[model samples]
Target: MSDQYLVRIEGKNTDIAVEETQSILDAALRANEWLPHSCTQGTCGTCKLKVLRGEVDHRQTPEYTLTVEERAEGLALGCMATPRSDLTVEPLGNVSDDGVPRHPLRDYEGTVVVLDDIAANTRRLVIELDTPMQFNAGQYAELIVPEHAGARQYSMANPPTETRRLEFHIKLTAGGLSTDGWIFRSMTLGERVSLRGPLGQFNLVAKQDEPAILIGGGTGLAPLKSIVQHALVEDLVPELFLYHGGRRREDLYDVEFFRDLEHRHPHFHYRPVLSEEQWEGATGLVTDVVVSDFPSCKGMSAFLCGPPAMVDAAVKALKRRRMAPRLIFREEFAITPATSTAPAVL
Candidate 1:
């Protein structure tokens, strides 16, 4: 018999056919539906959803780390869970109501307007997109370098405006594609390249006097910069504390940019934390500083963008400070080679 199943979500019905191996999240994304997901292997609970009906058998996940009560309530991480029969599921949060774009993988060709080294490990590249692209602040784009197989994704360091140019701060990885391959390392002004994007949901929302905190490490400052600029342009005034951490003074490339912002907005404060700097400034792990500075982040919302270790540390630290888990948003930069086809476990 042909395998088929009917799934209902938020009062909408759709048919799904599984061949005993496909995950629910994969099938939903394949159908052009957006699901809140990260680390698609079940490390992160971003894909957690309420399994309203039918049974599901989830593959062993490194961090399926759910409470007993939570598991009893039919909650499953969609990335690892496979539907056993017809089902209804409630997506964790407010996902895009409409389906994603038909071509999720967009190709953008553009000229390099500006290319400069922001720091020893970071380079800022400005690309003027050939086509008009609209993306929320704190989002990212993937660049398909010439003669390379896998694309490199970077967050926009600037906010979206009517302008056609996009900026990215790329951290050079040794022997990594795009960065080590000399495409970005050897880029010059007015050069041409291809990119695709506007991915991620780490953008800010309109709120009245909400207290906000931002934590970043190394090049993770890219998306945080976009978020701050977006708020400034939109005139959304919120109490913000931005903590940027690096190993040395040189790694804290855009400290001046954020310092200027603090000067402009009295409600904003920028803290630069250097782990290995020889200067007399805030020093320690970025999250360690955040936790120490704001011992009780009880009523504030937070945004984090950085390496996996940093993101994980921030989450743990915030939760310990009595911050609401739902209020903390994050975006992680995943850079990997095409040769290693390891499945991303969220």
Candidate 2:
């Protein structure tokens, strides 16, 4: 029996070799075959596909995300399923050309230049890469956890122009393998780490005319920061509004950075909202504040990144305010189970 199996995509002239140890999605992306995916972990069901003709070992696929009935009905998560034999699969989501630039996946090694606590429970990590990585503004990279045999996904906070250095805002999770066990506790500056590049499809659309509203919660601000910087540099939008939400003032970081941008750019606006503590700026939920500011979002496009609850609420609020469904893009920060030693999404 061959250790590697050939997997063919339905209706596409694409066939890739998948090692028995590799996930189907990993191999597809390495072959430059774009597929819809968010968190590369098994948490998000975004990578769900139909296994048309072969067997797959659905390893580590969460039951909550991929139900037993779905598996029995020929459904599998491309991020978690490993080929048991030669396969034929069809991605559920459309992978048509949308004019967004897709950077090929590659491995890179980097030294940790800076690591500091930026917020209450979040830390700012900067890595100087050995080779430059080309990525879309909102795409993410996966860092291999030393000695853990797993990797955690973190969005680059810097713009794509800074290809030689990668910036990440990571929120520490209690007892997390990559967080508590490593980044927050044992990791040090000048240390080296391995990482993979330019993952995820949540990115800025090309040639968009409408003003953009970016909302972020906790460390979810990482990718939005990249987007805002890129947009301002390229003048991608007529106006840009950034709202970072936190439970208290201590939870918010980069206040001065955004304030400076707002001061310099007449079209840029920055709002920091505190939910648990009363602040001089906006209060209550971030989504509520946005709703109050924009009576109608009919002519605006929005990018939301945050916890699932917050993202879901923002989507609902924007939709009620008349924002078109297609104009709203979101990325939910999916935290892994505390007990499980699996790689998590930040």
Candidate 3:
């Protein structure tokens, strides 16, 4: 038998060759078949698909994400399952004609230019790529962590226009192979690293008319910063409000930067909320502050990024204020199983 098997995407005229050791999602992506996915790991169930035929090796698929019953029912996570034979799989999510632009995945080499401690346990990492990567604001890149034989995903903090230079806000995770073990400890300036470009579907929708409220927690502000910068530059929305939440003042970074931005744009507002520590700024849970600020979110859109609990709270808050379900977009920052020792932060 051939080492490679042809996998067909049900309902689409697409057939991609998948190596026995390669993931279905990875092979489909390389073949320019866009599948709904986040985390690119087995953690998120976004890439779960129905295996219409053939068998698969569900390598490293977490039981919490894909249960035994689901696997028995022919469901497999595209990101973790490797084809055992020729297969036909159907993505559970709809692949629609949404106007969002999809950029092909590519590898790039980058050198660390600036690495500084930005917040309490967060660091600002700037990498200058050899070639410009075209990506929508709020998309993320995966840094290859060869040391642990894995990769860590981080959103681009800089605007999409700054294609050559990418900025990432990395919160140090205890015992994390990419954070404490590498970036924060032994990594140095001018060190070259390999990374893949422009992953994730979370982004500022093009030509949106409703005002946008962006909420972020800790380093989750990275992608929201990119979205805010791009939105303000392009005037994509009528108004923009950004709320960065932290447990204390030490957890918040880039306060002055957003303040400066607000000062220049009359339609833009910035609020920094602290939950654990009392400050002159907005206090209490970030989602609570948003609720207090906006009595009605019926006509506005919201973007949220943070830990699962925070994101879940924000979503509930927005829905309570009558925000349409389709208008609310969120990205929950989480560490994959490989970095299980780390805290749940982007």
lDDT leader: 2
Residue-level lDDT of model 1, residues 171-284, one tens digit each, is 888887578776556778888888766555577746546588999888899888888887877776568888988998888787788888889998889998988776878988
Task: For each candidate, give its TM-score against the true structure.
Answer: 0.74, 0.95, 0.95
lDDT per model vs. reference = 0.73, 0.90, 0.88
lDDT of 3 by residue, 177-229 (tens): 88988999988999998888788889995978899999999999999999999
Which regions of candidate 2 fall more than 4 Å away from where they truly are? 338-346
Which regions of candidate 1 fall more than 4 Å away from where they truly are?
A: 1-33, 38-105, 338-346
Scored by TM-score, the top model is 2
lDDT of 3 at 213: 94
RMSD of each: 6.0, 2.4, 3.1
Evaluated at residue 319, the lDDT of candidate 1 is 95
Candidate 1 backbone overlaps, count: 7
How would you encode candidate 2's per-residue C-alpha lDDT over 294-324 as one tens digit per residue? 9999989999998999999999999999999
